[model samples]
Target: MLELILALRNALVQQGLELRAQEASDWQGEIPLPADIARFYRDIGPDNCNLATAGNSFFIPALARLWRMQAGYRWHGISGERLTDWHDDWLAVADQGGDPFIFETSSGKVLHDRHGGGSWQPAPLFDSLEQMIACLATFDAVWNSAGEDIFLDDYSVNPRHRERLIDALIPLLNSRSAAQSLADELGW
Candidate 1:
């Protein structure tokens, strides 16, 4: 978890993004983390929730809502001009087919759900959030090179932080494929 947070901090700064910190007190009982999710915050400090870049943001309830879309939109370019937030769940987390949202299901399995036609086409995307976060380490590389023309379905765990994130990963994983995919995706 710390590994991911550090990466986020560095990534935000690299992108010249602004940082906003949230405290547990700020939640004001409006949004709360269950035990499973609460543990993740302990490392980074529960009081500290939302983090953002200049044009992007990540808040707890975590990148997605329960069995629904997250932000429901995506930036068309690095300049982030064509922003659109959907009023419904089809775009849960992001534009289903137009932009892929690799998100956690209510059952804890990560799924890739997107839409361009009119409905969500959800497919198994990852086994665990930890595994997904690990794979996202390559996001900077992909974004730097490809921008909007890329598919980020592959996932892997960094050997250096494997054990470190496992505790957090185990609680949220519901399928073995997420683990298997890690090995298959990054040759772990």
Candidate 2:
């Protein structure tokens, strides 16, 4: 996991982005982070780099700004009538615009909830935090290599670049189907 995180940092640096590491003391939440998640925050947090620059609105906030789902609802002043099914233990680790990628503390799984929909039942996106990081790194590398204008007007990757991305991600993710699924999710 540490190796994967370092690889991600290196990939971001290759794209000419700066990263900020977090101090151990910066994490003051009572909720404990999984080891790999903690390592990610310690080694690379508060970075301005958008991991989903390929026509996606994803952003992972710094460790200091990380909060749980319940806190987010309260912070946004979401009324009870607007609330949906949410686990208090799920942390909002990252987001694609308002849709959140949540980390379930008890199950050690990552979930993604598409906001502005029906019941807020998030589905499993990644098996673990490491998988999510790897997917991001793979996508970042392929998208950047394809060039800045890789995405079309509708925010979908150009067909050529989409194939390139799928090809590049297959071996890293160990499944062509998985690669295709990720590309589709990223709006390929």
Candidate 3:
């Protein structure tokens, strides 16, 4: 997996693209990691990603998202049949020049590069509780708007599978919330 990601990173570098890494506290600014990639997974949570690790390498989903400037909200586990399925889907999109966005059999898709270019430099979009609330509220609208169309449209609609992904993602999101809170209090 790491090798695959590296290969993609090499390809993107050849194209003169870059990733940014970011601090959790800087909600209104881009961190050091790829902002576009971070924004795609931003819904999943912030802790699962590290700019230092992602900045120099290419992750297929990240690459796909970067390539497409996709903000689609698809999430897949690292070790599972679902992961394999998602990877296959990602490759198909990447191969087709369909835009490097991540898609899942469960969730429909999240458009990352809706702006026509991936964000090599992304800014954090939150800083205070108000900011956080606003960000969450906006995302909530996005999340709810999709409703079952993305999550419950097919395999992801299965109780076990849907619950599994959400369950896994919730803790990560919570941890992100806590971490952000701490960072804010410390003036980070």
Task: List candidate 2 stretches off by more than 4 Å.
Answer: 1-4, 28-36, 46-48, 68-84, 148-156
lDDT score, candidate 3, position 114: 22
Candidate 3 per-residue lDDT over residues 7-34, each given as its tens digit: 4334434433333333333332122333
Ranking by TM-score: 2, 1, 3
**TM match of model 3 to true structure:** 0.20
Off by over 4 Å in 3: 1-156, 175-188
Residue-wise lDDT of candidate 1 within 1-188, one digit each (tens)? Answer: 56766764565445433334433333322234343333333332212123321122233233223223233343334554434543222222222123453434355545554346454456666554444433333333333344333323343334333332333234334445554453343323
Candidate 1's TM-score: 0.36
TM-score of each: 0.36, 0.77, 0.20
Point out the worst 10-residue segment of candidate 2 by lDDT.
74-83
Going through the candidates in order, what is the number of backbone clashes in each?
11, 0, 30
lDDT tens digits by residue: candidate 2, 40-126: 677766354467546565676667666443354423445434244666667777776677788887787888877777557788878
Q: Highest lDDT, which number?
A: 2
**Could you tell me which 10 consecutive residues in candidate 1 have the lowest summed lDDT?**
46-55
